[model samples]
Target: MSDGAPDSLIPYDEIVQEALRAVVGRVLGEVEAAGGMPPGSHHFYITFKTGAAGVDIPAELRARFPDEMTIVLQNKFWDLSVADDHFSVGLSFNQIPAKLVIPFSAITAFVDPAVEFGLQFQAVSEVEEAEPHAEPENDSEQGAGNGVGSEDGDDGSNVVTVDFGKKK
Candidate 1:
């Protein structure tokens, strides 16, 4: 047997990212199959790029989060649907509901604190170029939902932040 490292001609990052995005799709699909958020699980925190292709965010939200934004999918959300290329969900802000269409390529993080499970991905690109490492910000201390507990009591309302950094 060879003891040397194996060579790779394919871009592993792209392949991994694609696979991760598929996990997001599969999760959403499960939610859809259930006809709603599972019992005791009523929300999600989906963060994505504001400028990525196929991302449809409100002008106000876009301005507020010019580069990235995290959306809460809880009691006030509706019309949750997922497609091969994108997913759409309706959310309320100030009691005004808005529909957002986010492409999987645009999604950066997906979290469901109730189960302590999460996924992170690199932004998708339309151009045929090498996918860059646009790592998601790890703001667990600032309550960005990285599975870190807080002073607040445990009500299954925790948020999970995605960390794209390699474990050292």
Candidate 2:
């Protein structure tokens, strides 16, 4: 059979992306409901695109991260607020405090290593334009602290893959 073209019309990518973003929102909502990070667990690794629309990263951070960046939420974080379209959190870097506001649409990944749970997202597009600026000293780096549990099972290697691909 010749691998050519099929005639059909449906917006699967958008639908899947929307659903995945919801999962992020729901998770954050749960955390918010719990008042704060649960005992023995106190951080997150949030990776997102610097250029995504509605993303409100600091000017300095934009320059350093350029394309993408990961943030750590632990000891020195505060005012964590999650909203329908986005979420905001305050984190300290080198004794300097900075606020980060990220739109769910811009998040490319969310991982809670303490629980061995992680989620990967597809970037909206590669052609998206990003603003250029320098990252402030107040932006925290990724994976800077240690929490309670291992991010894996016995052997320390396990990954759960969720394929949102459409069946032909």
Candidate 3:
């Protein structure tokens, strides 16, 4: 399986990641277009880097989730707004209503268990209008603020994480 080809000259990995992340945006945009999550069934479990630049979350949720958090968009969320690079939503945590603004570049994982579909990306900060985003402060290579998951499906869900073992 080794053709002996060297490393890629172009940042193909980053390019592919961005395109995949766009899927998340497109899905959310559809929801926004419908005025909210469609009449029934579909939902999302989005996990993102809280410390990533352009991420605006409540201090309490920030303190609680710190590096990352998984939010379920099923019933309780409101005022869902989708933008070109980010999305804003209102959700309740422990009876506290809070608003969060997260840039697509900060999202590390997106899952829709109902359809058994999910995606995990190599977490990177995306460029924003006027201000360039910065890499989130973290101590892990797996990114997403959360620790690494198992190679097996033990981590739960049918999420498929693609890790191209190419030389950097």
Candidate 4:
């Protein structure tokens, strides 16, 4: 990994990203099983690709965010449903309730500040071998507009980002 060129035999980056994405599923599943977040100040800020496959959100929300958006799971949310590969929930925006269905593959970041936990992923569409994007100015930085964090205002402790090269 220290070398400039990646190894051809192993898709180590993709494999690791997949595993981290699974952690998103497991955590969501746990919250679903418990009826809600455990009895504490625990909550989640899930940032995802709005345009990714399997993502379903209101037109207004899509129009507003277009590319990515972060949602907070705290009070006043309803209908928490978790599936093998996706999850859905109802949240309020400016007093208007909206239902959002997001596949685990669409998520880019997951953060739980109560425990300072976070996992970042590359939206499946962002790293397709068939499509290439311009490089960022710095290797440590993400592409323009890809670094938008949550508007939820969680004291941001450990946000993670994993770039598989394409996954939006």
Candidate 5:
């Protein structure tokens, strides 16, 4: 080839990202349909942009996180409602019950470390750089050990992490 590959006119990256986000929705919808308990040892660590559009969380939580927040879907969550573009669930923070509504677009990562499976996505919303926040302490009494899985300490071969950096 005389010239390098031309930049794609098609928005393949966006298409692929949206498709992966749908996978998250489908998995959550199945869990919601199955009475809110993930099948067997499959638990999730879902990270989302706290300030993204259509994200409805408590003001206190928003203030605390102010950037990104990850929640566990294992031992203690309820009223999970999954829609095509969003899902809502009830969780606890500091023993206080709260409801969170998160759009799939706001999600940045979805991981089920039980099987070392994960998906990383680029943030769908524009966000400013900020200091890293602390891990959320949801009321997961037995929530997959540390809530980020990897308890077995195996190499993370099953995780899917994509980097679509364009050629310089």
Candidate 6:
């Protein structure tokens, strides 16, 4: 036998990623069903590729975050709507209210800092890497700063990380 493992014919990574993305959809759906309000201190930090297909954000936001952007869904947000493959919500940027429509496929991370739960996924798009930009000003208090992509002091036991380790 060869030292390397043989590649499997199944697209396990894609399947698993799709399934995991559904968790985000379900959570958002619950909030939507609750009259667009999150229960208690629950909030979410959603990170997505700005250039990904089916992503719709204000032109200024797109310009500000040409590569990727992270939006917080907490107090001061409204119109929380969730669809099968996408979700849209209204959030304020610099006190300017804007509606963002982001597809689940474009989402790379979802973090619920209130419960220290998070999910990280591989990019579904061939996004060109660019300099990281500051998080958008959503007019919400920057709490413990448990950002979806941050590796803070938290043990992150609740964070679900998926890495297929595809061979080149």
* lDDT tens digits by residue: candidate 3, 107-152: 8778776767788877663423312233344333334445322232
Pairs clashing within candidate 2:
60-134, 60-135, 61-135, 63-133
Error of 3 at 10 (Å): 1.5
Measured against the true structure, the TM-scores of the candidates, in listed sequence, are: 0.69, 0.72, 0.77, 0.75, 0.81, 0.83
Q: Which of the two, 4 or 6, has more TM-score?
A: 6
lDDT of 1: 0.65
lDDT of 4: 0.73
Q: What lDDT tens digits, residue by residue, belong to model 2 across residues 55-166?
A: 7877877666666777876656778888998898887756778888989988777777776676666666531444333243423442332111224335453333344454
Q: TM-score winner among the candidates?
A: 6
C-alpha positional error of residue 43 in candidate 5 after TM-score superposition, expressed in Å: 0.5
Model-by-model lDDT, in order? 0.65, 0.66, 0.74, 0.73, 0.78, 0.81
Where does model 3 exceed 4 Å of error? 1-4, 125-158, 165-168
Q: Higher lDDT: candidate 1 or 2? A: 2
> What is candidate 6's local distance difference test score?
0.81
Better of 2 and 3 by lDDT: 3
- Highest lDDT scorer: 6
lDDT score at residue 44, model 5, on the 0-100 scale = 90
Residue range with the least summed lDDT across 10 consecutive positions in model 5: 138-147
Instruction: Using TM-score, rank the candidates from best to worst.
Output: 6, 5, 3, 4, 2, 1
Residue range 1-168, candidate 4, lDDT tens digits: 464554468877878888898888888788889996644888887888776777899998775666667888987788898998899999999999999999888888887877877777765644243123323242234233354443333565566666656543
lDDT of 5 by residue, 1-168 (tens): 546667789977888989999999999999999898999999999988787778899999877766677899999999999999999999999999999999998887788878778887776634323223423353233232222323323574466655565564
Which candidate order results from sorting by lDDT in descending order?
6, 5, 3, 4, 2, 1
RMSD of each: 6.5, 6.0, 5.4, 6.5, 5.9, 5.3
Residue-level lDDT tens digits of model 6 in 49-91: 8877788999998766666788888888999989999999999
The list of candidate 4 runs beyond 4 A from truth reads 1-6, 126-157, 163-168
